[model samples]
Each structure stands twice: as structure tokens, then as C-alpha cells.
Target: MNTRALSSIFTAELRLLVRNTAVAVSALLMPLVIGGMFVVSGLQQAPAAGWGFYVALMLLTVFGMSGCIAAAGTLTYRRDELYLKRLRCSEASDATILAGVLAPVVVVTVVQCLLMVVVTAVAAESLPANPVLLVAVIVFGTVCSVGLGMATTGFASSGEQAQTVATPVFFVLIGTAIWAATDLAEGLSTVQMLSPGGAVVQLTQLAYTGAPLSETASGALPALGGLVAWAVLGAGAAKRYFRWEPRH
Candidate 1:
């Protein structure tokens, strides 16, 4: 509701985000690096979902990781610099301040996804078959990533240590999501549906295939539940555990 405060905060966040080359590139660079590795190993040319799907999905995966890292790292950095604690003294409310910090990161996340779509279509000569699903996956994944980032800063001692602390969770969740996507493709086993990555992929595929939601309940429900659970838990954990000052 504080439009002026929000705008001011958003601008500041944008400036800071772009000023750090490492953070700025986190969203785009991480995925491109992973994709190049695939290309180098010749796995990109393999038969699994074709190079296009792999490229597109790989891009999505990277964005998810980048968003998480940025969210966690930025907050941790600000806390280290005492920005978060100082903002508590401003006219802006806590919610307003939080929104401002996250807004630009969210915008960058969307742009990265849009860029991924453009690049995949052009370079891979591929089509998204279900453009809506692509949008949904990216949007949902962003929410999940950003929320997770907020949660991460809750425990971070310093900006420098954030990468080390946050990496395991990022890799575990994403790794789980990836496994489900690959393992469940052949059939819908109960265990497979429980995987977050699998669930996201199934939802994505259903969107692509134009299949009805009814057929995807196996993976969809649990996956949606998992995502929802994480979102709720992360936000709650953030609220309950987040510190406005440097732990030191």
C-alpha cells in the first residue's frame, strides 16, 4: 500500500543487484554453464526428451537455483551490512521493506525465463508445445525459489557464508525435483509422484500435452502439496526465525 516506499525500495534493490556482477549473472549464468556442460558431454544430443527439452528444462533449473541464491544471498548481505536492522527504523513497514527487496529479484527471474523461452525456440528449433505450462512452471518455480531464499537468510550468519549454507538445500530440493522428472516419465508410481521435481515436470508435461488435470492427480496433488507446504513452511520459518541484524 505504501507505493512511494515500495518504489523507492525497489529502485535501490535494482541498483544494488545489478552492481554486483556475480549476483546479477547468477540467474542467467548458472543455467548456461550447466547447459554448456551437457553440450560438451554430448548428452544434449542424446535421445532423452531431445536437446530442446533438455535445454529448456535445464534453463528453468538454473533459474530456480539462481533465484534462490540471490534471494538468500542478498538478504544475508544486507543483514551483514546492517541494512535490514536500519530499515526497521524507517517509516516503511516490515512487509513493505521485504516486498521492495524481493520485487526486483522477481522481475529479473521473469525476464530470465522469458529469455530462456526465446533462446530455446531459436537455438534449439524447438517449440514449447504448451506455452502456458512454461509460464506456469517458471512462475511457480520463482515463487518457490524466492520463498526458499527468504527462509535461507533466517539462518545465515553472514553473506560470505550463505552460499555454503544454502547450497545443500538448493541442490537437494532441485536434485529431488530432477529425479522425479526423469524417473516418473515412464509411469506414475506412488513414490515417483512424491518427488517435487517429478511433480513439476509432470505438471509441465501435462500442460505441454494439453492433457486434462484429472490424469495428473498422482503427481500433481502431492507435488502441489509439496510446493505449497514448502511455501508455507518457508514463509513461516522466515517470520519465526529471521533476524534483522548480523548474528555476530
Candidate 2:
């Protein structure tokens, strides 16, 4: 990989993200606002499992907005503007280009997630039982969201269209996460474990609840496998259909 090229692209993308007021607000500020609300709300006083629910919600919100939607919109804008085409002509490989473009989004999402964790912990007056597991979930979940975003870019013809196209995905993710967190669909536990959003929620709850990996392997393993499966599928879809320039 072209580290220098990758660095350059990442820096450029970061600058652009800052300049775009709408995207910046949606990806960065929204999480803080939502987390702040949680801190002051009655949810903070709920039992320990409720705190886990809050953390899971924060993760879902950030992943959906920053990692998935923002990535899709940014990539679509770049492609529409021929920015991606210019990058394709550079010495950087396709993988490096994609990484560079998506790196800022991924970094931002992870940071927001970590920040939410701290906020939730302080609000609930307790740190995560399994810090390592929580971090793992954050990292893997961010990657999965990015992969989904990349795939979304394949169908979005423009930046504006990207948002509309990504809405259903974002909602579905949030819905499944809620389902997993609430256990409303008890019989569908296996189905939930297989879904990307549900898997993330399941893992986040387990991490916060202090469940040991070995003890929770039956559920955790499926959740992890499900996340991996979604990530791989997203990557495959992006590889096949992603465009470097405008359709016209």
C-alpha cells in the first residue's frame, strides 16, 4: 500500500469533512447531542442492564450516521465530482484509495463511540465490566458500518441520493439493535445474532454485563460471526458495483 498517498488522501478527506457543515453536524454533533440527552434523562437511573442499553443505542446511532451514512454520502460526492476518478489515476492502489477516503469516517465514528462510552459510564456511575470486549465491539462495529457504507455508494448516484438510499439501512440497523437489546423477539434470537445490527447490540450488552467470553461463547460467537459475514458481504458488493465517477 502507498502509505504516503493514503496519508495524503486521509488528510484531504478530513479537511473536507470539517468544511461540510451538514455532514459535520450529522456525523459529529448528533452523537454528542444524543449522548448528552441520555446523561440527563431517567435512563441513567435504570439498572445496570439499562446502562448497557444506552451504550448500545449510542453505538448504533454513531455507526448509522457517521460510519455508514456519512461514508456513503462523502464517497458519492467524491465520485460525482470526479475526485475518486482523479485518485484512481494516482499511484495509490484501489485499496489504499478506499482506505484513505473512508479512514476519516471510521476514525471519527470510533472516537464518538469511545466518547459515548465514557459519558455513559460517568452518567451511570460505572465503567464497562469488560473494557477490552467493548473496545473490540467498537472497532469491529465501525468496520462493519464502513463496509456497509461502501456498498451503499454503489447504489447512490449522488450525495443527496446517498442520504435517501441509506435511510432504510440506518433504520433497519437501529430497529434490529433495539430488538436485540430488548429481547422482544425471544424466538428470533438466532436471527438477531445473524444480523449486523443485532449482533453489535448483543455483543455490546454482553461486554457491559461482564459476561466472560467462554461463558457467553454460544451467543457471542454467533454475533461475531454475523458481524464478519455482513462485513464480507458488504465488501463484496462494493467491489462489484462501486463507481469511481458519475454515472453520466
Candidate 3:
């Protein structure tokens, strides 16, 4: 990878992302709104799980879903405009180009996650039981989301249709997260544990409870495995189907 080329591309993408009003609102402001609502609903009075769960959910929702959609939107938009095609003709390698495009979303997600942590800590005195494990979860979630976003772009022929294709995916993830939070049938709960979004929520809930990795390894291991499987699957799909030029 050409470091200089990657840096330049990353800078440009970051600037464009920040300037887009819709992305700015969703990526930066939406989490704050949701967190505030949680606090107002008396989450602050509960134990670590209260604030911790809310914070983790917000991070995954904003950083994972919103960030993923933004990346997918940008990819499809660029393809429609032929920008991706033009970029491919440059000196940058394919991997470098992809890295550059993905960096901005990753950076945004990290910043938002940190901000949410600080807010949660100040409001509810909630902190991660295992900070290292939490970090790993965040990294895994981000990678899974980004790869899925890229793969989703393969189905979109234009920017408008990109929204159509991504919406169902967005809702399915949200639905799974909701189902994971509730008490459900034994069979359904097992299914949720096996899904990427559900696995992240389970791991986040575990982390929030301040349980040590050794103690929760039985649960945490499967969640981690699920995320890893999704990451691999999403990456493979993107590699096989992601398009640079617009489809005719």
C-alpha cells in the first residue's frame, strides 16, 4: 500500500463525510440524543449494567449501523458518479483505495465511541469491567459493519437503490438486537447468540456486568466466534462482488 496515497484519500473522504449534514447528524448527534433519553428514563439509577448496556447499545447502533450505512452510501454514490472508477486508474493499489475509503468511517466510529464512554462515565459512573475486552469487541464490530457495508454496495446499481438495499439490512440488525435484549424462546435465544449483532450485544451485556473473561468465557467465546464468522463472511462477499464501476 502507498502510505501517502492512502493518507491523501483518507483526508479527502473524511472532509467530505464531515461536511454532509445527514451523516453529521446521524453519526455524531443521534447517539447523544438516544443517550440522553436513556438517562432521562432512569438508567442512571441502575447498576453498571444500566449505563453500560445503554452505552454499548448506542455505540453499536451509531458506530456500527450508522457508520456502515454511511460507508455503503458513499461507495455507491462514488460508483454512480464514476469516482471509484477514476480512482482505480490512479497509482493506488486496490487495497489502498479500499483502506482509504474505510478509514474515515472507522475514525468517526472511534471518536463517537470515546465520546459516549465519557458521557456514560460522567452521568452514570459506568465503566467497562474489562477495558481490553471492550476494545476488542469494538474493533470486531467495526470491521464486521464495514465489511457488510461494502458487500451490500454490490447489490445497488445507483445511490437511490442503495438506500433500498441497505434499509432491510439495517432493520434486520435492529430487530435482532431488540430480540436479543428481551426474554425469548430457548431456541430463538440460541439463534440470536449465533448472529453477529446479537453476539455483540451479548458480549456488551457481559462486559457491562463487570464479569471477568475467565468467568464469561463460555458465553463470550461463542459471541466472539460469531462476530469473527460474520467478519470473514462479509469480507469474502465484498471481495467477490464489490464493484468499482457503475453497473449498466
Candidate 4:
């Protein structure tokens, strides 16, 4: 990793993010607005499961919008403007360049999640059963979201097109998370556990429900595996299709 180059690129990206109204709204404002609604809607009186759903929903919203769609749009814009091509010609390696480009998105997403957790805890008047597990799952989810964002850039010809191409994926993940939150038949439950969104919901509920790691290992392990698989698939797709220059 070219530390100096990475720092330079990361700083520039942050400045650009602030100037970009669309990306800034998606990354910062939308999640806050949604979360505020949740709190105002009596989140304090809800049960543990309700809190779990809230956490899951927030995660989906932030990751899907900021981590996935925003990342893709930002990448697409950079490529379209020839920024990525110029970076490619620099001394930085491909990995470093990509990392620098995406670092701001990742950082903002993490901060959002942390803030959500704090707000949720304060509103609900309770702490998660397993803070460690919650942190781990959040980190894993961020990775999956960012990787998927990278893959989404493969299908985007421009910044606006990135949002269009990412919509289906974003919806699928949100749908799966909602599905996993509901009661399901055994076979369907298994399928949900294997899906990226469903896995996130499952792990999040478990973390809030105080399920012991030893006792919940059977279910948690599979969900964790599913997240890992999705992350890998996204990375693979990005590696195969990500472009440094915009398509004509």
C-alpha cells in the first residue's frame, strides 16, 4: 500500500464527498432522517425483537444507500471524470487506489452505525446482549456492502446510472432483511439464513436477544458464513469487471 498516495487520495475524496450533494445526502442525511422517525415512533416502548428490527433496518438503509449505492456512484463519477485513470497511472497499486477511493464511504458508514447504536441504546434504555458480536457483525456487513458497491460499478456507465443499477441489489438486501425478521417455515428459514441480508438480520437479532455464543453457534455460524460468501463474491465480481476508465 502506498501510504502517502492513499492519504492524498483519501483527503481529496473527502473534500469531493462534501461538495457532492447527492452522495452527501445519501451518506449522511437519509439515515439520520429515517432513524429519527424510528425513535419518534415509540422505539422506547418496543420489545427486544422490535429493537432488533430497528437495528437491522438502520443497517440496511445506511449500508445500501451509503456503502453500496453511494460508493458505486462515487466510483463511477471519478472514472467518468478521468480521476481514476489518473490515479491508475500513479505509483499507487490498484488495491491502494481503490481503498483510498472508498475509504471515506466506509468511514462515514461506520460512524453512522456507531451513532445509530448509541441512539438506539439510549432510546430503548438497554444495551445489546452481545456487544462484541454486534460489533463483529457490523464490521462484516460494512465489508459486504462496500464489496457489493465495487461490483455495482461494473454495471454503471455514469454516476446516475450507478444508482439505477444498484437499486435492485439494494432492494433485494432490504427485502431479505425484512423477510428474516418475520416468522418463516423451516425450509425458508434455511434459505434466509444463507442470504446476505437475512444473515445480517439473524445475527443482529441474536446479538440483541442475549443468546449465548455457545448456544447460538449453530445458527450464527451459518449466517456468518453466508456474509463471508457474499463478501467474497462481490470482491470477485469487482476484480473481474471494475473499470478505471468510463465506457463510451
lDDT of 1 by residue, 1-248 (tens): 68999999899989998786666666557766765564444344644454433543554465455767777778888888888778879999999988998888888777766665566556655556556556666766777677777777767787656655666655765576567656544754555544445545555555445445566455456655555555566567667766777775
The lDDT, on a scale of 0 to 1, for candidate 4 is: 0.80
Model 2, residue pairs in steric clash: none
Q: Rate the local accuracy (lDDT) of all candidates.
A: 0.65, 0.78, 0.71, 0.80
Q: Per-residue lDDT tens digits of candidate 4, residues 184-248?
A: 32323778988877888877776777777788777778888888788778777778878887866
* Candidate 4: stretches off by over 4 Å: 42-45, 48-50, 184-188
- The local distance difference test score of model 2 is 0.78
Output the TM-score of candidate 3: 0.88
Best by TM-score: 4
Query: What is candidate 4's TM-score against the reference?
Result: 0.93
lDDT of 2 by residue, 1-248 (tens): 99999999999999999887767876898878876876676353666444666677788888888888888888988889889889888899999998998899999999999898887776676577767667777877777777777777778778878766776777888888877766722533888878877887777766767666677667677887887787777677777777787865
**TM-score, one value per model:** 0.83, 0.91, 0.88, 0.93
* Winner by lDDT between candidate 2 and candidate 1: 2
Model 4 lDDT, residue 12, Cα: 98
Instruction: Arrange candidates by TM-score, descending.
Output: 4, 2, 3, 1
Candidate 1: Cα lDDT at 23 = 68
Tell me which residue pairs clash in candidate 3: none
Worst 10 residues of 2 by lDDT: 179-188
Q: Which of candidates 1 and 3 reaches a greater lDDT?
A: 3
lDDT of 1 at 17: 86
lDDT of residue 104 for candidate 1: 84
Candidate 2 global TM-score: 0.91
